[model samples]
Target: MKTISIFTQKGGVTKTTSTINISGVLAELGYKVLVIDFDTQCHLSLGYDVDKETEYNVEEFLNSVEPIRYAERGKHQNVSVISGKLKLSTKSLKRDSLKKPLKKIEKDFDFCLIDCPPKPINDDLGFGEIAIFASDYIISPVDYDAFTLDGLTTLIITLDELQQREKLTAQYLGFFFAKVEENTKDFKEAYRELSESEISSLLFKSYVRKNAFIRTSINTGESAVFLKPFSPVSMDYRKLTDELLMKIKIDAK
Candidate 1:
């Protein structure tokens, strides 16, 4: 099984949205996909409308004395999800109980996408380190803002440090611009500046445009691909997924 972690140190960058959409795209393309909501907020779980009925949250898998099965086979199709609850973050419970359950889940799913928490929580409990160690690739979502560049830099540095300290070998998949508004001057400027920088190669050419339909789809517990496959936002995600598949193929070689 191949593991990918959708992560960012900063919040409000659509990390959970990216995870849910990407998983949906992959599943639509006939891949067996499992999304693990590692964040304490449980937004990914809620986005799929699996929050309340989910029997086993991430916390249960970690804290339970016996081997836990957290994944809920989706009522729809090939997609499955391991939900996360708000209480998972209360005592830093998710961070403490991740490793074993993750290993088990990795064995079952063909592709595992982890929706990681924000940077502060990751750093406080060294969750990022564990995630980096386990994943085959790391996908970071960055906004079209000046400060996001700084966050990207910190992410790169953290990965480098993890590589040095742990001899980690995960491939860096680089950044995807999320919720971008290219018509706006500030957004255009930020994109232009990033394009001209040294990190340009790491920035994905396909970016997600800010779209209400996409948000509405998530809110309604349906994927953008399912709700509006022909929309520009859906097309962008398809492109991003194509790029990701290419990277995964190259890495597997």
Candidate 2:
């Protein structure tokens, strides 16, 4: 199975939203996808409308020594979710702890997508490194801003450092712009700068446009793609997923 983490150090960049829609599109195409809520906010879990009262969550799974259990299913038959908890960041988890547990069920799904929290590499939360260590690839969702752009650089540097020190095997797949408002000057300037930047080659051609469907999806507990399949933003996600599959060299079944 291919494991990927949707990550970025900055918040409000639609990391969780991207994870949901990408996985949703994959499920729509008949791929068995597993989504892990690695963030403390539990936004991804809630987005899938997983049972909140379930006895097992991502934290429990990580901390438990027992056998692996079945994951909670979403509306889509092809999708399974490992829910997140609000207190996950408060606990101290060992680095690479998620790797072994995930290995137990690697054969069950075609792809595993992790919804990581917005925490810097050096932060005490430790969720960032844990998710990265467990992933085979990392795709960051970036916003149009100086801080967000700088955060991308920081992530690259951090990944390089981890590669040298911890022997991290996860490849930095590339980045895609999310929540884009193309009519804005900020968007134009940022897009131009990104195109001319040293890391321009790492940018994805598809970008998600800002829309109300995306904003309403979390409350509806469904991916925007499934909620409004023909919407422009949803169509953007489908194209983005296509590019993602190409980047990973995986054919949609």
User: Could you give candidate 1's per-residue lDDT for residues 1-253 as a string of tens digits?
Assistant: 7889888788899888888888878888888887777776778888888854456666676664465554544324767887776755445543325555667666666888888878642445644555656678898888877788887898888777777876767778889898988799987887888899987877778889898897798788877887788898888899999998887897788
Q: Which residue pairs overlap in candidate 2's backbone?
A: none
Query: Per-residue lDDT of 156-194 in model 2, one digit per residue for the tens?
Result: 888988889889999888899998998999988888888
Report how far off residue 166 is in candidate 2 (Å). Answer: 1.8
Candidate 1: residue pairs that collide: none
- Local distance difference test scores for all models: 0.76, 0.85
**How large is the C-alpha RMSD of every model relative to the true structure?**
2.7, 2.5
Q: Give the TM-score of candidate 2.
A: 0.92
lDDT comparing candidate 1 with the true structure: 0.76
Measured on C-alpha atoms, candidate 2 has an lDDT of 0.85
Q: Candidate 1: where is the Cα deviation over 4 Å?
A: 52-54, 63-76, 89-97, 121-123
Pick by lDDT: which candidate is best? Answer: 2
Q: What is the lDDT of residue 149 in candidate 2?
A: 87
Clashes of each: 0, 0
> TM-scores, in order shown?
0.88, 0.92
